[model samples]
Every structure is written in C-alpha cells, then in structure tokens.
Target: MTAASFTAGLRSALRQRFRTLALLPRLLHSFWQTSPALSAAIIVLRLLRAAQPPLVLFIGKLIVDEIILQTASPAPGPTLADWVESGRLSAVAGWLLLEFLLVATANALARIGAFVERVLTERHDNALGVALIQQVASLDLRDIEASSAQDRLQRARTQRFMGNQLLTSLLSQAQDFVSLILFVIGLLSYAPLLIVLLLLALLPTLAGEAHFNAKGYGLNVSVTPERRQMDYIQIVGSVAESAKEMKLFGLGAYLAGRFAELADKVHRGNRDLAARRTLWGSLFGAIASLAYYAAYAVIAWRALKGELGIGDLTFLAGSLLRLNGLFERLILGLTQITSQTQYLDDFFSFMDLRSTMVAPSNPRPFPVPMRQGIVFDKVGFRYPGKGAWALRDLSFSIPVGETLALVGENGAGKTTIVKLLTRLYEPDEGRILVDGIDIRDIDIAELQHQVGAIFQDFVRYHMTAAENIGIGRVGCLSDRPRVIEAAQKSLAHPLIETLPEGYEQMLGRVFARGLDLSGGEWQKIAIARAYFRDAAILILDEPTAALDARAEAEIFERFRNLSEAKTALLISHRFATVRMADRILVLENGAILESGSHEELIALHGRYAELFALQAAGFQ
Candidate 1:
C-alpha cells in the first residue's frame, strides 16, 4: 500500500478500536448509576485482590526461609505431636499460618469482587436494554426498516452477549495489572533482564491475539445481515402466527435447511479465524516457555554460586513464573476486551443516530380544538433510498368534521399519505399543515396524539383484551371502565364477552392459553385501538380489510357517530366503503387524479369509475 492509503487504513483501525473501548466508560457509568455502593465495593475489592498474589508469594518465601532456619537449629522432640507440644515447630507453624491467612483473605476478597461484578453486570445490561427500548420507540419507521440500520442493530444486540464478559475482563485485567507491577518490582531486585526477556518472548503472542481479534470483529460485522435473516427465518418457521401457514405449506424442512446452510457459513468463517489464531498462539506460547526455562537456569546457577541465598532463589523464580503468567493473562484479557468492544460500538453508534423528524425547539401544540383541519399543501415525500417519490405534490384538505376517503390500488401511495399525516415520516419537499400552521413546528408528541391511526399492519400484542385497547391510550391502560367503553364503541366488547375471561382474556397465540381471534374479530379489536385514542384527526389506513360486509358496515356506522365531532380520514380499496365518505380522492402515480363525491366520480367515468365498475362486476 502507498503511504497515504496505509496511513488511512491504520487510522481507520485505530478509530474502530477506540470506538470499541469508548463503551467501557459508558458501561462503568451505567454501573455507578445502577448502585454507587456496589460500584465502590467492586473497586475496593479489586484493589485488595490485586495485592493478594504478591503477598502470598512473598509470605511463601518467608515460610521457606523460616523452615530452613528451624531445621538447622534442630528439634529436641521426636514425634510430630511431641514436636508441636514442646513448641519446636512454633516458628514454622506461625509462618505457615500467616501464609494461610493471606491466601484465605485473598480468596474471600476475590469472591466478593466477583459477586459485586456480577450484580453490576446484570444492572448495566438491564439498564441498557431499557435505554434501547426507549431509543427504538423514538425512532421513525424508516429508521427501523433500513437494512444498514438492521445490521447495526444486530451488532448492538451482541453487546448483551458480551455484557458480563466486558466487565469481568476489565476488572480481572485491572487486578492482574497490579499483580504484574509488584512481581516486576520483586523480580527487579534479583535480575531485571529476565523481565525484558519475558516481554520480548511474549510480544509475538500479544500481536497474534490482537490481530485475530480484529479479524473476528470484522467477520461479525460482515455477517450481521445474514445472521439477522437467519433469525427471521427461524421466527417464521417456529413462531405461533406462522406455524399454521408453515405447516400447510410444508415450509418446516425448507426453513430449517436454509437456516442450517446460513449458520454453517457463519460457523466456517469463525472456525477459519479461530484455527489460525490457535496455531499462532501455541507457537508463541512455546517461545515464552523457552524464555522462562532459560531464565530459570541462570537463577539456579546464581544460587549454586552463592550470589543469591535459597530464599532469594525461591522468591525470584516464583515471581518470574507469576509475572509471566499474569502478563500473558493481561494481554489475553485486553484482546478479548478489544473484540467485545467492537460489538459495543454497535450499540453506542446506533444510539447516536438522531431522527430528522424532530420538532422545533419552540413547538406549537396540535391545533387541538381545530378549525381548518389537516392540509397537505404542495407536499411531497420519497421513502429513504427509493429513487421515486411515494407521494408528490399531493395537495388535499381533510376539512374539519368531514369523512375524507382515500381510494387507491396497492403502491399508489394510500398508506404513505397516512404515514405522513401521523408524522411517522416527514415530507422531503413542501410541508404538511395542521389548521393554518406547518406541522414541523408542532410538538411531535402532541401531533401524534392528535392523529390517532390504525395502519393495516398494526401489531397484535400478546396481551390481555383490555390491555390491547388500553395500550392505545397508555394513561388509561389501568382504567378498566374506559377500556370496556372503547371496546364497546368498536363492537369488540361483545366479542370479548364471548371469551372465557372477557376483558381479561389474553389475545394472540404467542402466550399460553391465549385466544386467537379470526380476521374480522381481529379487525374489530384493532379498530378499538383507534377508538380509544384521544386524537382529533382519526386516520384509518385500510384497518378494516379483514372485516366481512355486515361487520364493516356496522363498524363504519359506529365510526361515523364517533367521528361526527372529529375529522376522519379513511383509506380503503373497497368501492362500496368509499361511497359513504363526504368526498373521495382518486390517487394514481403519487398525485391526485380526481377529487369529488362518489356519485360525481362515477358520473365522470374516470379512473375511479373504471375501478369501481370492475369491482362492482365481481358480485355479478
């Protein structure tokens, strides 16, 4: 590589590595946020534990020296018990007892540190999970649907997998570092060159570990989209909703086979990286082992030549062995930290993304207690990444207290309009106005609250019947009476009454003993959500597609009564349904092709009439 390119590549790698470690402070802050007492305990305990290894080794040396001195002095007693009783072994026993106490105290401190670390890990994981939920909830639909976003999300999700590992590695590495410093000091007193030799031998191993860790991180990022796809396939094959369809289609084997193939691909990539890492690691480990043995011979010769005493020889050798082991462990811990930190970058980077749909700093309230109603004034929007506009120059008015129906075939921008109206997305050009004011200036929360909508793809939450409707107005989720009232308005109360638990009955097949409703029944339950909402502009985006003719009529009848004082926007392909609206707009190719009453459109014999006649012929 040329100098510029090489420098850029190195900079990129360093930047990525730094980004990975950035999560460390954030995680520590989360720990402190979780429990200050636990945080303090962890730090103090790690410090105590850090000193224990050196203390134990030094004490062992003292015990050996004491034994040698006592042995030379000779004992008057013969038997072991007699020696103890006559106090001949008292000095040696005291030395041994002291070493034992130091070891015991260290073990206790280690256990306490582990316990506090474990608790802190759980708390940080839980806190991050909550933070993730809040962030995801705040994100627009566009943010969640992007493939790049999904990959980033997958990487971020891996953080939970490393939650405990990150904490354990960091704290353990800290303790080992302290032990290493003390060992170096003790070793320096005897021969400092051994430490230099040891580092030279271990450099290859550390370099190998770091290189492999970077490779593993790179593979993880590359395979995220594939991994996410595999997860989706698994969900569809095994989950309750798709179970029936999967069984009917015999897709079980197909999905499983696909999953296996994809999983094997990921496994092979990981194996290849791991195999090379292991091979290099073994070679470097042998090199380190050779250095240690070579140093051992020199220490032994010095002791034989009387340059060092027996106690000094023992302490130096022991310290050399410990320092080598601790240094190796510290390097391995650091590599592991680097690898795990890459996953953490996923989370922090994902959280850093801000939505462009944010409201103005000084926001206006929804023109609540409305006047002119919502107007799409020279508005245009194209979904992210799509070259063509989903809706363009779509000027229309949802006049206050009027039932405005939108008619369009699939991909004709029906739902896109609803999405824009609800501020799930913002227009790329022009603006949407609420009353006489631009919606961009309105408080996002207030705007959303005033535009209660139930899209075609609304969630079927695995919750109780009451909760399903109550979630629409979270403030009244616990208000049983309001939930029942909303259910009654959507005509779901009667269906709910037929259930074993009435309003308390669980919905969806995801949960145990949860009842699954038919399409029409589900439609009723979903409509209840919009009914429960306190929005001034009610937007129903093809939410009644599953309902039968009579049920559709009854629901619309109720909708009419409830929406009399509220502005209503209905989107549907059912021609029979659109006839009830005060006015109808025919949308084609992202623009308004026709705007009039159903009778006028039918008389005009335009696209609206053509489509109406086509569907009308279906009954014949």
Candidate 2:
C-alpha cells in the first residue's frame, strides 16, 4: 500500500478506537454503581501516577546541582556553604526527598490499579456474557440453524476476552503518555535539541511493531477454518454423542491423529512468521540503539565544553532513558489496540444481525384456551439452500381434543409438519391458524406456551432427572410434585426409581455421579417432559422409536388416557401404533396422499395400504 493509503487506514482505525472508548464511560458508570468506592480509588491512583515522572526528573537536576556546588572551589559566585546558609540547598534537598516518596507511592498505586482493574473487568465481562447468551437463546430456531450463525457466536466469545484487554491497555497508555509529555518539557528546558532526537528515535520502533501486529492478525484470519476443524474433532472425540461409537469402532486414535496434524500445520505457520518478525525487530532495534547513544554522546561532549554543567548532563541523560521507555510502551499499546479492533468488529457484527423472523409491531394476545384446533391452510416451506420444497401447498386440520396420526416414509415431510406447528420455522406460503386466527398475529411467547412438542432427536440435558422432566412446563420444571406426576403419567417414574438417586440423579455421563440411561429410558423422560407441560396441544414425533414391541404397545394403550382433554398429533412409521388414531393422514413427497381412519385408508388401497402391508409382510 502507498503511504497515503496506509495513513488513511490508520486514521480510520483510530476513529473506530475512539468510538469504542466512548462506550467505556457507560460501561464504567455501570461498574461504578456496582462498586463506587473501588472505582473512585482506581481513578485517583491513575492520576497520581500521571503526575509523578516530571517531578522526579526536576528533583534529580537539583540534586546534581547541589553535588556540583559541594565539590567546587569557592568562587566569585555564591559558595556552597553560603547557599546552604541562605536555605536554598535545604529547599532542594527537601524536594528531592518528596520526589523519592512519590516514586514509591506511584509503584504502590500501580499495583493496586492492576488488581482493581482486573476485578472490575471480570465483573463487566460476566454481566455482558450472560446478556448476550440470553439474546442468542431467544433467537428463532431457524436462524440458529444457518451456517453463518456459528461464526458469529465464536466471534462474540472471542471479543469478550479481547475487549477487556484492549480497554485496560488503552487506559494505561493514556496515563503514561501524559507523564511522558510533562517529562519531555522538562528535558527541553535543559537541551532543546534532544526533543527532536527523541522523536526520531521512536519512528523505526513503532513501524516495526505495527508490521508484526499486522502479520499476526493476517495469520489468525487465514487459519480460521483449520482452527474450527480442530475444535470440532476435539469435541466429537470427547463429547457424549460420539464417545460410545468412538470406543466401539476404535476411531479415537484416528481423530486424535487428525487433530495433531492440524496443530502441527498451525505451529509451522506461526514459527515461520515469528522468525521473520524476529529478524526485522532486531534490525530496527540496532538502528534505534545507534540513534539513542549518539544523542547521549553529543550531550556528554557538550557538558565537558564548559558551556554546560553537571546538573544539565544528569537531567538530559535521565530524560532520554525515561522517554525511550515511555515511547516503547506507547507503541506496543497501540499495536495491541489495533489487533483487538478486528475482534470487536466481529462481535458487533454478530449483535447487529437481524433475525429473519421478527415479531409483529403489535402482536395480539393468543387465545386463552385454544377453543378451536390448529389448521394449516395451503402451507409450504423450503430449506434455506435447498431447491425442493420440504412441504408443499398442503392443507390439513385437527379438531379440539382429538388424536391425529401422521404416517409417512423418510424424507416425506412428516417431521417438517411438526416443526411448523411448533413455530420452529415459518411457512414460505399460506398461514397456520389457531382458533381461526393467523398464528403470526399472536405473540410468539404466548403461542409457544400453548404447545408442547417432542421430536425424534430430543435434547437430553445433563441435569437432574426431575429437571429433565420439568423442562416441559415453563416455570413448573422445578416443582417436585408436578415433575413426579408428569413422569408417572408417561410411565417414566418407575425407570427413575431404579436409579441410585431416583429423580435427583444426573442423566449424563459427563458429570461426576452421572448415569447414562438406555435409549428407551431417555425417550420415556422426553415424553414425561411433554406431559409435564400440560399444554393445550401435544406433539409426539417418533416418541416410541427406542421402545421394544411390548413397551410401544403399552405406551399406545395409555396415550389417550394420558393426553386427556389436549389435542394430540403423533408422527410414527409403525402402522399398528398409528391405527388407534381417530384420523390418519398419509404424506408422500411433501403432499398429503390420503386422509381417513386406518380402516378407511386401507380399503382405499393407496399409499397407506402399501406402507402398512409392507410392515405386516415383514412380521409374517
């Protein structure tokens, strides 16, 4: 890039940094409310440190003058003894002592500042983290399933860590820069030419540091895919879903080897970049060191020429050393802020993404009791990137307090139907209605409250058994009696009683004292959760998949009694289990092929008859 372009980019980056800093006050204000005394103390300590450097340099010059006077022969000028008698020497000595005390005080204050800043930053991070997570959890299920959503989530987490570090570094650098400016002024009063030399000395070091930072950020962005792959492998190798299969198939070693290969590639790339950076950094250091010592030599030579004195030499030399240290720290801080800005961009981008499914400007309250049943009026839907529709322009309805069964082959849109009813995804065409009102008009939260659903792939939380069941009902998940009653209704209570801790036992092997339940047992727990909800509409999708013949038979026999007054929709492949439904709908390739009672459909000799006969033939 040309110099002009680079300068413009740097200016833009600085502007962005200012914007982020502008946000810091509101953040700090929040912190102050939480802990006012500590925040005030931290601000005071920073101010004190900012005032210490110039005072120390001024006192050092006076002490050098006093020493020179003490060693000189008595001349026409005021003698050392005369000056002491006049109290000038006493005043200089007192100032030197005070400077020493401030130095010690600054050090103590710095340590306290470090501790307090760390504690407060952590507090802020935790609060923000919780808020962000809550927002993510509230997003529509369809939004979360998008491919780009995971990248946004990863950026948010990384930004939280980098944002804290950037804030602390920026604050510390501001204080140091203020102190450096004052010290430079004191040095200029003694040797004006040294000011120009100090600026020249900082240029090469800053350039070199900026180059290294750019390389690091470029490397991080380039390796994102590799890093993500490595992370995925690690999760699969260690997490519950893959643990049993990994061991049984002896695939652990293979996954570990893949992980190591990616790690090695990352290490190799980093090593090469580091080597190049070290070479350039050393070259810059040599050039800077030459300029620094040359300035020192000129100052020393000028002092010996009788045009300068001992105090002048001491002040000039001390100021040069202090300026170099301050300049280095400032440059490093700038580099850190620049790199962290990219992470901040990623974070804000995630927060800025608009959810595709937005609530209406003024949502209507849902019907209190769902007097009429749900109706899908010519509904259709297609996956985000797929060409074919998962559901076509199909219309269906179920009456209140009735059981409807959906039977279909794999990829026949049966599960997609349930998802739409649960508001997991919005239809591309037409609308679904509850109580003859469009579902979109109702408040989403209220709509969800009235529906309970169990999917083929239900989440098995790594929590206590009671919690697992209680999650079906909003706010009643923790009510012990309600949890037990739900579990009993679903025929899951007997299975829980067999465990060591009964309903309180942890349900996943990842935690200490956790027990992994059988698939059938887990399915029962999921059913219990749905039962616990006590929602007006209940959906069971392949709820009997893990059960044996006897268990499935028993579950179907108790289904009507357990459901009671609620409208139920069951999606299953087993003809025998679905035969008990008041009405059955046969779906094929995103369209309803037939709808009737099982005997009526069988008599039609259509898709339902074909599927039912196939299963019966298997038994024969």
| The candidate that achieves the highest TM-score relative to the unseen native structure | 1
Deviation from native of the Cα of residue 175 in model 1, angstroms = 0.8
User: Where is model 1 poorest over a 10-residue stretch in terms of lDDT?
Assistant: 1-10
lDDT of 1 by residue, 422-466 (tens): 788889988888888898898888888887788888888889999
After superposition on all CA atoms, what RMSD does each candidate show versus the true structure?
Answer: 2.3, 4.1
Where model 2 places Cα greater than 4 Å from the true spot, the runs are 1-38, 73-100, 204-215
lDDT of 1: 0.84
Residue pairs with clashing backbones, model 2 = none
> Model 2, 212: alpha-carbon shift in Å?
4.8
Counting clashing residue pairs in each candidate, in order, gives: 0, 0
